[model samples]
Target: MLNTYAIMMVLTLIVITIVISLVTRKFNSSTANFYLAGRKVGMLTNSTAICGDYFSAASFLGVAAAVYASGVDGMWYAIGFGAAFVPVVLFLASPLRKFGEYTIPDFLFARFGRSHVARIIGVVMVQLICIFYLAPQMVGAGNTWNVLVGVGFLGMSPYQTGVVAVVIIMMFYVAVGGMKGTTLNQMIQFWVLFTAMFIVFALILINGIGSYASERVPLVNPATMTVEKLMAGEEGSRPYDQAQAVMSPEAFAEVEAAVQQGDPAASVNVVLPQTNKLHPERTMTFQEPGHRYDWLNQFSMVLALVLGTMGLPHIMNRYYTNPSGKSARLTTLWVLGFIGFFYIMSSVAGMGGRKYVSELSGSDPAIADLTVDGLLLKSDQIMPVLGKLLFGEFGLGYVAAGAFAAMFSTVGGLLIASAASWGHDIYENYVNPKAPEWKKVLVGKIAVVVMGLFSLLVGIGIPAIGLDKAYPSLIAMMVTWAFAISGGAFVPMLLCSIWWKRTTRNGAIAGMLVGGGGSILFIGLNILKETGVFPAGSFGAALGSLAFPSIFIIPLSFAVIVLVSLFGRQGQPPYVNSIWARIHGTDALSERVRLAMQEAESRGRA
Candidate 1:
């Protein structure tokens, strides 16, 4: 049955979107107004909007799921996500806004003496990053819908229902409201999500009514009819003791069915319920690191997330919506504060989930009913599962609303970013340079529809290919791939162009080709190996780490760019002094505007 409260929250979201659309409708007539909201977004609103766009399902659900499943190592994602802003504030935020471009391609082309090569490269990279990122958002939306509604519409599967519904709704808002409506919606959604998350954390962690990772869980030996403490998995090995702890007979049969169908991860490790390795007398705590990530994995994951934030097109484009460079800097500072608090809540949610599933489920008959044959079959479903267990349908409704917020806000920003890349950067520049403003806006709307449909298709198909098993884990992995690609392909070149005077167009192109191409290739190989296209062995294990390629690909990109620039005879980009002065100077808004205009006019002459 559909939850009435969930339906009401979703309807409320629709109504708010409609009101914002009506209010912002007048601002959509011009390409400039449509894309950047007339560059009038304030610091607090912009920061909240950015958080709405940045958090996504990955941060909201995936981080919590990671912590629930893996314990202390899961906190690494929260740490990396929060720390990502440090570089954004110190290096990119103000300079990027001062540079003043509609898109990443726009900035790169203007910075590199209006090189068409740079613009085309930027469009390609932006499309790659946005498209890859878009798929996971769609998948997460579908996952949320399954939990919220628990039923399909018009014979469509639950996953398909989610993908179609969210895509169509977001496409309408993005197309009609453009950036103005999307920005306002994002700001509103951020608060809704933040409030929902805080409530869950307060109830679960502060109340101490829920189980924590550090607490000992009770497990029953089906054969012996005896109860014992359940131990946590330690570093360097899987806990066979847990596998040996059998579920109900129905669950045991299901495990056997899964193993028979080629799912080794689900296969049981013992013939009977066992507890020797579990140390039934002791309790396990999640106070240490290295539960899932080794030192190398930790370094690579952190590097990708940090460097990747700089290159993400959807995020970089937000700076352009700021009225001035100073506004952009302030926005970044606020974003840092918001993101830190949000991640703390995410950690709490994860711990709460761990506590709920492990320690609390067996104590209460009502809570026990929420489990699948006495165990959490899929860890990714931890949040929704907990919602129903702890607070019934009302809690599920609130969580569903928050999940929708996470999905819709990020998807809205991404579609706009994709539309701008295709319509303004590619079509306006290459296909119809003389197109009028109205025609350009029309093209942007069309691009939004096209991109939304494409992502929706990918989201629906992901489950058929067996990639949707662990709800948030698969989503997180795909998102990390997008991050890795962005970090390798764009971060090195972008940072060099802004900070180093020696960066040449040729060098940037070389770096993008090597870094971007290599990252994609590595991801493809990793996918192939994962899907059993490559036999299991050393080669497959090596390909495993390649899935997170920033550690290696980023360094390689830096080297390629530096080496190519050193050998190239290209002169310094025109008006380098003025560009640097504008980037680093602390001038009044009007003075900054004058300098920006002068720089643009110089680029026009060149």
Candidate 2:
């Protein structure tokens, strides 16, 4: 349908992944290597890997799409991603690494002497988040493929087929490579993503500089309400005349009847129904004829990003792979700098989408072109769509490569984390205590394949149920639930173990129950129907839209854990010396941090 660049880019990306994963096979042969790189990663590499993992299909596509669709207010997700890292840096990173556990539950079990509850919760959250994440990625893959190839399956679009293919590929890498494979692959993938972004920016600027079509702009002269002149004389659009302005006051006011109608364009149909209630500008047009800014709430939007990043499981697990607490902290800073730079590039491409394409290509094309099209490219496709428009073959190829790299990188991380939770946290500790190291690795590898297949099924099912449009949006919401639950349920215990010393085992369990359970339960009930469970409706239907139930659940969870811990006699955590070494080990990891990020790691670690 489009061109070969898209297909070629994807093929090259897949080939590289296979090559790299196969090479890293040595590292993945052992259970420890597959799961956590044998706990010996350097700061810079670890941090870069973390950023690669942290930035999911959502960051690559969703955030920019949100900004394009909703305007400046859409930056909340990025802000949340950055904000979530602060707590990790300030509190969690060091103690987590020092605890010397394979997963979060392992720490809970080691500290509290009852690992079952934490193990169950860890597995549950990992499974849920991974599935939520995997579905959108699969949909993204399919959508990309559909655009590159023909919609192939007996009337089913080619895009859907791509999703299945991508998932299968992901299963292969994840099952074979484990954490070692994933880490190396992700590091390389991030670089590809960055390079593709650069190409996209360059191509857009090339077209924009000598834009032969700038003259076709729909200029709105707020003062005269007439055709301000097309950009250097475009051919198609008709000049705004008095007669036309009077009828559609929203877009254009009629010059002839407007004297009688009295600025009739003020109450145009395009404006939202309740625009007057919020702002002084009573004009109801969707695009304020002459103005550039869109009305948006910045406060809560940033709040989400701040909180969401901390809860992200893939990023969190990266800290545990470091050799020392200081290394984990240093890696986080590197991730921040790395991720932020790309965000700047992403925004530039988003603007390019608005300028070059003039329409969103989310699920359909030709519906709304140009301004609305940017909104249509499901959150992940925003950058790629813009690339296709500006660079044509070369640009499209670059973007396809970047997108796959991002997708694979994210999935690879998630699979490893999931494996770590199930294989290391549950299987080794509880299911088969006597299992050998090699055997555990085998089981973990098997778990990756099983989990991946399950993820694929869920991804395909989302579209079948007609909620494909909502997948990206749902992932962000689910992440919030993850963050709120983790922050509320576990943060208190983690803090107590390191600083409070009075936190008791009983309190940790109660808090986990109250915080984790409460948030999960609330989030679960809130999405009951939208998940495609028996198409019901009415006034009661409004309840499901109250989707982010975690808003309420998070605070409740924190309060429960703190109170429970306080009620029981706080006892000192057993791993205090090791935790202290990790949490405050500037000297211990000076050598490790020096290894990867010799210069940059020094200040942040200190």
Candidate 3:
């Protein structure tokens, strides 16, 4: 009964979001406004909008759930996601804006002579990111629906209905609103997301969450029934096959002593000389298990975050919305500050949710304890579920409203960005050079419909995609695919276009092809064949052994770009003084930026 209010609240929020998006179309009706918010968005407003778009289902729900599930390893997701922006600030943002291309491909095409190659790279990368991104958000929407509204359509469950509604709503706004409307919606949605998250987390402190003693998740495998399995393995069996055998003399002696003394616990816990981390490798269980890391995991995660941000097309495109390179940089600084605060709050909220939610501990324990329905559930479902648990139906409703807004705002940005890739970068720029203004607009609108439908299709299967009950881990992997492909493929092109005047057209093409193709093939043939789509034998298993979306790809990409660039002799960057003047600037930038943008708008192909 109470759930109806929660559902209503979310639907209301979705309606509000659509109305707001439709209204923002007033800024400017040209391609620029539709594609880049007319390139005149204020630093503060734009920064907030970026946060709305940047903090996907993963950031909001994934991080907290991870921490709740894993000891120290789970936090890595947040670190990597947040810190990745540092690279964006240092190398990509301002220059990207100044280059003034609508999409990543547009920049590549204009900067290099190979428009076709750029178009191909742009399409592949965008398609991958969009799929990875769209699926999880749909999954999250399903979870939200089940919790807030009850699952019962043709026995279709609330989760399925939520996925349908959310995707439809996302497609609706993206098709109707375009870029200008999307940005405005994003800015508003981010604030609501932050505020709702804050209220729920703050309530946690009042209820005493942070100060609660931290404890390890109870180790138990009801299947097969044994304390050995319960404490250290799976299905009531020992996790290791001696798996505890000490190879070194020093380690062997220690193990022998512990075993002789009949101290199995000590024997299990004993450290081997060559081994790192007191805990040996085991299936990392977070949200039921996987994607685990150590305390420094945050540092590694942050490394990915800062470095990866240098390449994300959606985030990078925001810079171009500003009038000048200077405005672009300033906008990033603003984003960092806003995002930082929100992230800190996210951590607090997660910790709080962990303490308060009993059902998350699999409230129905007699059910065999094998499934999430048996003993506590995955952590990603913790946030929205907790809001309902603690805040009553009304509180759940508020959080759901925020969630709906977050989903719509982000989809709007993605749709607009996708539309631009098709409209400006590929169709208008290459296929139909003579394509008229109305044609470009029509093309963009059509692309939105196509992409939106595809996203809906992807969302349907996401429920079955995860390795465990906590679906966010899969969602995180999906989002990282976009980041990795972008960071690995586009960052080189983006930076080289701006800084290295000597980068040749041939070098750019090589880097794009090699980097993009290598990553795709590696993921498809080796990784995704098992994890994403199909299971493999030993060879495929070996490919799946490595941590995904990791730094492994970074070196290969950068090496290819530099090696290829050095081999060639063309496209050298401009002189230092000229480039410096273009990049650096001063305070009170709004006026100067606006004036510069107006001049560019006045002169452009429009």
Candidate 4:
């Protein structure tokens, strides 16, 4: 039941988006244009679009939900996401663009002896990572739709409607306009999401979310029921924690007085130090970190995000859109700025939602079922619920549109990535090498539809399979798993392929098998453990600690690739010298490398 005003806004956005895609349709005459925008994209535009593609539902909704639910522990996602680009800038961006292929598989095949074996392995890995990444965006879209529209469409639930709606809409644009259209849409979507977030952030600050005091700020324990006082020397030290201690008027008064007086020995029972408008006895602070992660999990999660950037298929594909290696390098600088600002705003929105919901629960205990610890029942609902509570229906509409924009922009990029891998890499290279440009484009469009449908089906099954309930924040958890797999499987091999000439096709294949397969197995086992299929014993606990497996899986992958390469005794490709010059040398050198690659392809080596 969307109101008239909200429906109009959403429909208006859809119409405008379709128009933009149609206008960009002429740019898809060849595989190069359809796949990489003819490598002519400028710096700022590509940078913004890359941000759009990189900031999926995980960044839009999951990050805020995480902060709302877990406090400072949540901001680690923002930090790691932004920090990921550092490695990209230093090692991958320029080399990837200079190598200049439609997809990662294309680059791998050309770099590793022009073997279809390497390309096939890359295609499989890309599909796995993209689909895993895509499902969360779909889930986030569904959650936003449930809040904004909350109506069934054509016998579909709100979540189902969202999944189908986004897939179809995004597929239309991607299949019709290809890389150029998707890039334009991503750029526009990023601006829309950023502006809407800024408005919400400003409104929350203006409305005084940080100005009130709370006497009972809720808290949760991640492991066992272990509670400790926030202050160093409280009266009752055993279990008189902040949340429980605030219930005692005599104890609370003494603590509150000492805090108010700013005594040197007085300790504050707060995590973030923000005013809790809902209750007078409790306050929020930003200093807490162990709410959701232990030391090992924290380090592993950061490792996954930091290294995963080099391996994300949709993200890496954007570098190919830049005109040159240098342009790609420059684009990353702008991306860093854009992503940093977005994450900062994400923290604001999360805390604002926490404050708002706490205020609501303070006024009425009946709303407690709708929330947990002053956050939504489903953590992903934080931003959407805040939209209506903070600014009414119009604000809800605006943020909901932004949510969909985040989904559409990322899904469009993913669809294009799948298309490039399937159409250019598999179809043209294997199934139909003599296919015409039009045929190849047609195949790509078909791939988009197929992949979109497949992703939609997977998204629809998330709630039924209990993934939404098993994970704290569905989008973040799923996205992190995708990152773990990417970091484990692709990063090591990619780095070796570019920086080390001894990398062989067999070694790359072995790494993917051992590292990627092991990560998937561990993730599956963790999910089973989380879903109660296995008892939580000491061994189970240790397995749970391996939730973020990239810390171990990555090193294993690097070891396998290196060990196999050293022993395989396969000589480097004939074009390795030119490839090296292209990756590390000038655009002139890149041109010569491209000519050499073409000569290889003409000789059937590619």
**The best candidate in terms of TM-score:** 1
For 1-606, candidate 4 gives per-residue lDDT tens digits of 364556776777788789888998899888999999999999999999998898899998999888777777788888888789999999999988888778889888878778788889889999999888998998998888877777778999988998888888988989988898899888988887888788778888788656322333444422111122244455655333433443445434544565457454444332222333223355444435665566777888999999988899999999999988889999999998888888888888887776787676444343344553444667787776677667767777788878878888889988999888999999999899999999988999899999999999999998888788677777988898999988987999889888988887788888887777888888888888887776768576557656788888999999999899999857368667877887778877887878877876788854
Which regions of candidate 1 deviate over 4 angstroms? Answer: 209-242, 246-288, 358-375, 470-472, 538-541, 587-606
Rank by lDDT, highest first: 4, 1, 3, 2
Of the candidates numbered 2 and 3, which has the greater lDDT value?
A: 3
Candidate 2 lDDT over residue span 1-606, tens digit each: 556777777788788788877887778766678888888888877877787786666667656564444333345555666556777778778767765667766666655534466557656765665665676677667666655565666565576577778778888887777777788888888888778877876776676622212332222111212223211134333233322433244333323333344453432111112122233465332222112212222332344346544545666677778987767778877777887777766655654655554432433342233222123424445666666666656766777777778788888888888888888887887789788778998889888888888877776776665564334343344444455555545555566655655566666667656655665565555455555452557444545444444455455655666677777664445544543444445644533432433244356556
**Superposition error at 179 for model 2 (Å):** 1.4
Worst 10 residues of 4 by lDDT: 221-230
Q: Per-prediction TM-score, please?
A: 0.87, 0.77, 0.80, 0.87
Stretches off by above 4 angstroms in model 2 are 153-156, 202-301, 359-380, 469-493, 521-545, 570-606
TM-score of 4: 0.87
Q: Write model 3 residue lDDT over 125-200, tens digit each, in one string.
A: 7666666667667766776666556555665766677877877787777666777777777887888788878877
- Which wins on lDDT, candidate 1 or candidate 4? 4
Model 3 regions more than 4 Å off:
26-28, 152-157, 210-278, 281-291, 294-302, 359-375, 464-472, 522-537, 570-606
Question: Under the 3 Å rule for N, CA and C atoms, how many clashes does model 3 have?
Answer: 27
Residue-wise C-alpha lDDT for candidate 1, range 180-275, written one tens digit per residue: 999999999898888878778777865573545555443222111112111224632323344444455655564445445654433242223223
Question: Residue 301, candidate 2: how far off, in angstroms?
Answer: 5.5
